[model samples]
Target chain A: MTISEIVKDILSKAEIKNIFFVACGGSRAACWPAKFFLETEAKHMATTLFTSNEFVHATPVSCNDHSIVVACSLRGTPETVEALRVGRERGAYTVAFTGDPAFLGDPDYALARAGKYMVPYRNSDKLSCLEGNSVKLFQFAVELLHQAEGYSGYQDVQKGLTVLDDVIAAARQKAGPLAQKFVNAYERKDTIYVIGSGPSFGTAYAFSICSLMEISWIHSPTVHAGEYFHGPFETTGPDLPVLLLKNEGATRALDERADRFLAQYDGGHQVLDAQELCMDAIPEKVRGYFNGFVLGSVLSDYLNLLGKARRHDRSVRRYMWQVAY
Target chain B: MTISEIVKDILSKAEIKNIFFVACGGSRAACWPAKFFLETEAKHMATTLFTSNEFVHATPVSCNDHSIVVACSLRGTPETVEALRVGRERGAYTVAFTGDPAFLGDPDYALARAGKYMVPYRNSDKLSCLEGNSVKLFQFAVELLHQAEGYSGYQDVQKGLTVLDDVIAAARQKAGPLAQKFVNAYERKDTIYVIGSGPSFGTAYAFSICSLMEISWIHSPTVHAGEYFHGPFETTGPDLPVLLLKNEGATRALDERADRFLAQYDGGHQVLDAQELCMDAIPEKVRGYFNGFVLGSVLSDYLNLLGKARRHDRSVRRYMWQVAY
Candidate 1:
């Protein structure tokens, strides 16, 4: 059977009344759709399940013949493989998906999802779950929405994929509108802090590693911006470089003036405004998030690069986040 | 002058051209109205901005004399206060509002928008921002909008707030329906994870601390349900309890399934099927967030209480966040 057909089979299967779909970061994104699919499919049950890292350790009980661990990973993260291993150990059925079966072995449902390298570090492994293999993991589950208990509406599981893709594409275009400015603001600064809220918070978490700490090896810290005002502000000074997620979600007056009000001795500041309206304006549902984030990412990328370009900046933690532990 | 009038004073005097507001976790919920306010106030030249903890520290560079730091904190967290302090030291005028002034002075613009309390910890402080502060922040900014640059239209701003408040209030009622279930879920789990996205993320962040972690002392973890599927899934098990924020702006599929699929584990689960339609169901605007979070928080409180009552389980984390330094 094709990927969708297999997903449909899993959707129709009469097992695991309460199912939890797990995955790695890649699967994490796909879990979005997987969630819709499972919930929509199993709406009739008391509840359908989905979780990632936190759940594996917490482990919610209640299992039956249907209880199984269906995990996904584009690269087959150790977490996914381990989850499947645990599922089998627990007498639950397990299905693992990956670009290569080598990660889990032949019996594991390692879907041939990987593609050629899109760039140097990035691989264009386009998994065909939906728009992107990432989307597919969830979309495939969404396609099973018809099976979820009490689920009434036949939600066009693919309703907004195209739009989302467009949005993401558009956002990616403007990825870092204020990268240089952030560096310029804190010319002599030694540390960088990235603040975000909601969905952007996750982006902020990854951004710090990729944008500055990873590339330039700068000591950057990510926080839930609201927490900064709680008490962390005392140490902030010209030495701290502040970058605000200018996404159009929850940040407004806080992001704008929060930095401006900092004491003159406070670190430098900038706003990476990836306004969501522009993100919401994507034509096709598929590009939605890509467009929304692309532009802001560009700006973010620039800030990290700008610091490296300056060369004279010696305070950069050459091995930021490079923990020996 | 009223807070609105004072905002106008600052905008005109500061010659503020662009403004961005920075908030954290739950308080970041203000981003919605703050954005509306800045755009309205500037007429054209100045736009609004919002960022979470991660972004504020990494990539914000755009600024002008008009720049100000408007920090929000109910608890006066160290990082946030320090961030604000950093802003002030950087020569940016700082305005802060908190439930407790132990670390801060009284609010001249608004006298402690809300009061301090321990039962709810700093959760009530976040409520203060949600109820009227966020809207007022927007309205105050709107009053400044006229000929600042080249923008006009308090119409959009007002409408947004009106709709936002009403929707938020209505959604707040979920606390009533889910309160008992929340408590019940908490009773059984060893660890609790609050999963959310978009505006709901802040709300979820608050629940993790106040409900499960702070008050109840449950081992609660807050995660972007979508992102949790990545690496965090390693933490899951049959006893983990989870709360899924069923708001529209989340990474849809993933969040919806979080509660139910999580239920399968028998660890524990609560589904806060909060819809935007329920936002206006709130009795008082000020009490909106407080009321909204009640059911879920109460559940967390109940769970924490139950665990302690049994002396069988311990709370999630000793501290909300590790100092990490």
Candidate 2:
């Protein structure tokens, strides 16, 4: 079934007053856009994003049958699977997104099968994040909102989806030289700080955690654009490598403020403004909503080039999967 | 009026379906304990914590007459005051916590008077964080839960509060040696990653942002204990200074996992376990609830010693109030 159809099926089962997006690592970061979407667009339904194990460890007192828990893990992360079980035990309608159903017999996938509904998606390694859980989870949120309240932006979102691939392609093509320039300039820095706000933060988080630290073994940390002035700004120095992802949404001002400061105090900082992405294909009113998608596409190119420059591969990891907790 | 009385008055004004804790920097970290309290303890209400500026820029569509907005700033931060105005404009029951009432004539505190319920509290500079917005905000959450649904732990919370000062004093005295040891070992490090989970995270965040970075100009980033494995663990090296604040709550296991890993990879990392604090003064059932408070008290000693060791004054700031954003 299509994502919207699945959302419809889940909503028809019971009244979902709240939605919980549970995952870990990049998968957890992927849920933020949906959480942001629900927070800004849905007036009646409450939403939360939780790390998978935290969801199981402190299952909310309100997580009963009235809750809808959506969990994602690329290849059935054990904690995420356990979270699905915890949600199911709470009598909440549980939806699990994982790798291909062909791997259902694997121990991780086998346990995740216990969720009420399971949806398989393309792995990020094989496809860009734009085509992976980020977009799918957001589609779930959009559909849920549309079915629940007849969201006026539903049509615009559908139209946006129709042209997202072209927009991402154009963005990736345009970002190649920028990514090369960033790698040449900041490849040797021990730590790189990424900044983003609003929906663009999820993409920033993915780059920091999944690409920079996990894959390239770089010390990269994400600082929310809004929160930069709070404390992270103190870390700014001429030698610091700062990457700012500017959003085109309401929180753009926060990003712009950070950009201005970076220019003054740390002129070497890099910024990838979503406003410069090829978003003309989407409706002008809904273009802001696609900032994450646009930025996520460009970030992939940046990460790929950085990995190559550092003689690191995206598949390299020291402890993940190699070590048991 | 007492905090409980204020909460009661707010509740009587309208049916509050959700609460938003709006602040920036340390104040934003202060709200997490209350947000966590409501998320885990309250069954009928939703809670969200937002950076003050973001709260003003992207105010949730759900924020209305049925929403309760609690904003905090030691002396009326501009963005926080703007957030209070936004909440008031949305017809949210706005509560503002600021500096002493005598400063109400100051421009900062003057504009903050626009909040529907202005609450003046002792600034952190004069008192401990335990006696400042941290405790006050959590009290608001506790009283809110008590009045809304007669929380069974209300008596325990009150009991906890009665002995909190004594517990903090004893913990502070005991922490002096540990703080000195940490300062002597890690004072030269350029960056320190503070780790914590559950309520303890708020204290860790405050230490990282308000103390280490803002005060000492040290590069410190807070890594959520549960999220450390996701990516940040890659940054673990023998030379890296890591401070882990262990919670005594359900999420303690997450912190323990990080502690175990840090022990193997970076044996010099310091840990301030809340369980070892003078928490015996409180009931065991509610002891975990006070982990943030307990650790917060101990952290003051750590920060003070670190500041003296580095010859950096906590009041020193390059831009905070010296320049415009």
Chain B TM (all candidates): 0.58, 0.95
Cα deviation of A246 in candidate 1 (Å)?
A: 27
Model 2 lDDT per residue over B157-225, tens place: 888988888888888888888899899999998778898888777888888887887788776767888
Instruction: Please report how far candidate 2 places residue A150 from its true position, in Å.
Output: 1.9
DockQ of each: 0.05, 0.70
Q: Candidate 1, residues A171-223: lDDT per residue as tens digits?
A: 54555334455656654554466765533554565555444443444444455
lDDT of 2 by residue, A1-325 (tens): 7777888887888888889888888888888888899988788888988888888887888888988999988777778888889999999988887766654324457535868777777744345544577788888899999998778998998898898888888888887788988899899987788899888888888888888877887776578888888877876777578889998878899999999999988899998987778888898776777888789878888988888888888777778878776
Off by over 4 Å in 1: A1-325, B13-66, B74-82, B89-93, B100-174, B233-239, B248-254, B257-268, B280-325
lDDT of 2 at B232: 78
User: TM-score (chain B) for model 2?
Assistant: 0.95
Residue B300 in candidate 2 has what lDDT?
82
TM-score of each: 0.41, 0.96
- Pick out the ten consecutive residues of candidate 1 chain A with the lowest summed lDDT: A113-122
